[model samples]
Target: SSPLPTTVFEDEATAAQKAIDALKAQGIQRIVLLSHIGYSNDKSIAAKLTDVDVIVGGDSHTLLGDFSAYGITSSGSYPTMAKNKDGDTVCIVQASEYSKAMGELTVNFNAKQSVDSCSGKEHLLLGETFTRKDAAGKTVTLAGADLDEVKAIIAKDAQLWSLKPDASAEAVLQGYAGKVDALKKEVIGTASDLLCLERIPGMGYSKTPGCAEATRAHGGDISNLVAFAFRDMSITSEIAIQNAGGVRIDVPAGDVTIGTAYTLLPFANSLFELDMTGTEIKAVLEEAVEYAVKSGGSTGAYPYAAGLRWTVDLSKPAGSRFSNLEFKGKKDSAWTPLDMGRTYKVVTNSFLAVTGGDGYVTFKKVNDAGRGLDTYLDYAQSFVDYTKKTKVLNRLPVSEYSTQAIYDKNGLLQQ
Candidate 1:
């Protein structure tokens, strides 16, 4: 209504009041606020703005818009809204961040006055598509083209980049130097044990939510571990910090496979390091979170803190949020407090380290950090090897979510 306050509120309460007044004047009975505000933030807003009907959001990449009273939803991506106290359904639908998917949310409002029954479904936008099973036992679905649709969407026949006749992969498209994989892989790493993102019996989802590790199990933690594991990577070194948005592939729980790794990191995102002051590093984090809702934002680039651990406050203003920063030494000793003057060799992908993703201007500053070869592939290989050796999870699989059905805080299942 009044400039639809976008991005993370910045002044949500004030903005909401303005919208409510304006909407009331329009005789808009039920208010549906479609936003990118994260789940936690959404809940806070819903509570404060009683007039607001339902908030459909994205930013956190959260899948579920409606969470049960217990406040537990599986992975942030592809979450299904649970339910609310008023019985009015709040829907959250997002076609995964990369535009690979389009979110379709159908809300049927009652022509009558009072609240009533409602239902909906979340689906991926498959643009005229085809499917095939790859040798890796994964089903690859590709976007197909109906000769008619393209003619309508594109301006002219000349707009079509090619007049040449011979072409095999019809749906293939390229962004930057990277080519899109028309074939989507179905599964990776078979597990006799469930690498469960779903909550288990006698265990809260937090105790072990299956599939939240979708990103980490396939790579994230594993790759960084390898990067830091190497003798060469160090603080004060120029390193590649990857945008987490790029790590979108999911590895279904099962047998460890090679093809799965390729699909997960379907990019030329090479490993590079940056020479950033401890203070500057904090600034980078702030940039990632603040800009997460905009083109300049990224949670994927949120620096997984390989070989280092630092505290980040999500609620704080973007830039000033992260505090008490520290990094574990190359020697693997106690964590050292951050020193702004001293530069550290932080490792990440080429995207964030150079491209200034998530408003990380500091990372773009070439004053110090250096670039390096992408060993992510090498690390990916090592993960499959490591899983084969361990034959099971070694690190503690943690579920950051909380729910009443599964168990209590201590991890003892609640009856």
Candidate 2:
């Protein structure tokens, strides 16, 4: 008999102004609106709204500080200034993402309750410097002054943190800690062999653990396991391909625990299904191999499919890289040549299948065309479910996969 509350609004500006008016009606003179709609949206809001004095914004993960000496790029200056509708200044600031820095702003108001001057610094947070590789995998040293400032901040934080602990919160955390300790030791699955997940730096290929034989195995043992888990969880798709980078680490031979699975496949990528034609599938593989060849075999676009296999010749040109493609619907089914005209139901992680992650452009295109469907299954949970259902995990050796070779100039297989 009653209409629903106006809880869901269409426009962000309308919702924001409504809240601003409500607060102003309550005798609030100055407003510092904290927002996550990103830097550009903050500017738009400040331009239209004269009531807001300051906006601390985020979500774009824009770095607004001078971090060049510390090897960080800044999008703009800290405390970026904006002009409001009433010709007043509105201060907007955003700290960078990944908890790497803190933005501090101080404002001084004039006699008329307007900000006279504002200044702040984005403090670069750091930990004890260790020998670490840069993004290009080159060894680099942290700046001495930055390192010293980090150490000082660490010491000061330690002193402040040691001053007091909330008794109730500490007790709650301790109870959770005890449960976590037990969960860490609880065995969830068992592995009979060591899964070699050693990947060549910049190259997606990997070698068997403690063995000399190397292969361009995109999924490797661990990633194959993850892909298999995706296929097992999907109701409409028989094939599952996960990005090689999604598999984080190697799983050792022993009992598998909750912690073990978490370390191996940590990210919360959801499973997505795609209704794709075999022609598009071939194109996706070609893009991956082309990326690898173009990047000197340094890309993670390599595919690791659960129900499909194909041959890749690195010596060949881009579109001709893949051949002898086959798909097996069931574990006991015979492998059949993939029909280029037939549409197949495929499954992959949300990152690669939906966002074209790791250069899966074909998948993203199909998804954007409304052919992709979200299964809403968490990747790690699928692995957990597979482990529980199967009860045993085994290392998939190179012998288990279809033949893959690199051709030399003379059309001969290279060693």
Candidate 3:
């Protein structure tokens, strides 16, 4: 591709500043910036931009205001105030994630188009709680309740769902719902053994051990299987890597259904291949290990690769966390240290290969340099293909991973 066009996308703060400057130049004061850059960035902009009066932001999924009445935790105060470089006041606010609450911020601007005073509250919308039979066959009432009078008032709201459904919309939803239900019960394949959904503790953020803990110490069964599937489908890939977060669930020791496959790899990310040297691959692994350590054992960034293996030492600093790196060209081949100078064909999800989701910035750099190829292969489908080919998924293979005494007996990192 003629060295993919270099288009520099500005970060949120820079882009917001550009827009604010433009508006100020146009004599537009009392500007309310609707931002999705997140709460922290909003505060940064408030501290930096003198012209912005208020910022309604999202993306950190931050909860603001005193939601204690509703039993929700507020991350920070509502309408957080900050002074700009010129000492002008700016107001910042954000609603929590997934529309669970709506923020109502009232901003009063002074004559100079700066915030004078502000007050706001987050309104939490909850479902109508009702009484139900307990496991002991006793009737019990849920703590939160919606009175009949309140229900009557809400019934008058045109936006609320009606007891009488719309004929056309209901028909469409019913058709799709039926199809979904059928697919959930449809068998795709089978497994000879159970794939534990519980995360391997001690290795990830948790410290509790599970049946699959050993496998996940290096790479879990689902992740390894997914990586193998990607390589199998690719034309130029000699190895494949999958992120732990991408593999969402486990396959039980029974028939593997379509639902099972979908649950295993829920993301829509496609397969991507790239030419990366052994050195770059090692760096990628190091990044993953460091991320796990820094995140207190978060598995999201942990890398699981087919035809690749390595050990991690939490005692080591960031760049040196990974060691004993090895790779194999085929299943029956002997393992060998990664050749730092040799470019190897590697396969990974498009999310990591292109945008570097979950902090795989090294891969993103390679993709930006036009060295990566977008195979456009559906990731979840790759799992399905592997299931059909293997026919039965037995227990996960023993891991080649190793880690030092990262924590002391008191559950703290050993110094």
Candidate 4:
């Protein structure tokens, strides 16, 4: 979220224009904007600006180069060119997220100081060491001829880099290495059953075996668990909603650790409590479902919740896709029909509550209306705390799943 007041902050395009005007007044025409707005916004801004020649972007974690040899997917071509207002080229480039790769771009300016050409590749940085799972399903580091062959293959790929860590940087990291390692290994709880991670029911996106089957009837197990954690940790929230993508990984049945909790909920998100009417709750769920399924938007928009349940039918049109909405308050003994006129306190992550991230427009509206409060409870840490409190983590019962039933476009039950 922007720290600057709304009255003080200018939109990206407007700010860029002002900066460009100042630069042009100084006889500078070749302007490059370092942007973190995102790929879509970068393209939009590029189309609006006539003087900006290049946009190096992040925030969307878009992979913009071919990485097929390494079995990685590319979002689009590197240096994606967009036409400015004057029809001049604007080069946009971004490497993938989490420091996995770096974008190397070369931009050429014409005599008029306009963008003439741009080219680059996203270089995937890697250590010299390589490991692979053997036939016994054990991870083993590659060595000897195998290691040599792996290095040879990496050397052949332009995007793949087999570089050694800088000694100075390694030395700096070494000071905190033990602490980091210990924190990662710190035990938090135990999972009695594998908590499967799935974005949408029956999508079969999980890498875990039988995960698709496990989640086909219900939604993501871990996502629902995260929602439960939020609601449980909150003092005033009646229900908690979590995006499917917010919870990252499958939790295999075993000892759960701080590393597992962090890996599962990796983002630096906090909890927020929102006062929303039941009508608003249903509206947000419909919005998320419409975005996730019918609209062909990111499946990550799919929602899982605690203290709320609904049946979704993809065969139905938007605004009518969800039905049988129900809610169970923290003190309620049984599930009851959601009263659209009644307002309820809902707990959600900062991403949804603050920025309305993942197409949750209703949340943004509620927040804008000053009906939300930031709990400042770290989302990942909430899971760690809940795990520590509960000691035994298990998948929520089917009845407790936010998505009670889901039907595909053909009206066939997905479960």
List residue ranges in candidate 3 displaced over 4 A: 1-7, 11-14, 17-30, 47-54, 70-92, 105-121, 130-140, 143-179, 196-219, 293-301, 309-326, 330-340, 354-365, 388-391, 394-415
Best TM-score among the predictions, by candidate number: 2
Model 2, residue pairs in steric clash: none
* Candidate 3 lDDT (Cα, 0 to 1): 0.71
lDDT of 2: 0.73
Off by over 4 Å in 1: 1-241, 293-301, 367-393, 396-415
Decide which is better by TM-score, 1 or 4.
4
Query: How high is the CA lDDT of each candidate model?
Result: 0.46, 0.73, 0.71, 0.88
lDDT-better candidate, 1 vs 3:
3
lDDT (Cα, 0-100) at 376 in candidate 2 = 78
Q: Model 4 over residues 1-415: C-alpha lDDT tens digits?
A: 6231245657889888898899899998788899989999999999888788889898998998877766788888998989988899999998888988888899888898888899988899898888899999999999999999988888787888878888999998988998888999999899999988999899987989989898897878888888998999997899999999888899999999999988998898889899999999999998887778755588999999999998999899888898999999888889999999999999999888778788898998998898988888998988899999999998888889999999988999986
Q: Tell me how far the alpha carbon of residue 303 in candidate 1 is from the true structure, in angstroms, after superposition.
A: 3.4
Can you write out model 3's per-residue Cα lDDT over 131-229, one digit (the tens) per residue?
Answer: 667789998765534457546654664322224346899899999999998987877688887665422224433233454444434435555666777
Q: After TM-score superposition, what is the CA distance of residue 202 in candidate 2 from its true location, in Å?
A: 10
Error of 1 at 389 (Å): 9.0
- TM-score for every candidate vs. truth? 0.41, 0.74, 0.68, 0.71
Q: Which one wins on lDDT?
A: 4
**lDDT, candidate 3, at 338:** 74
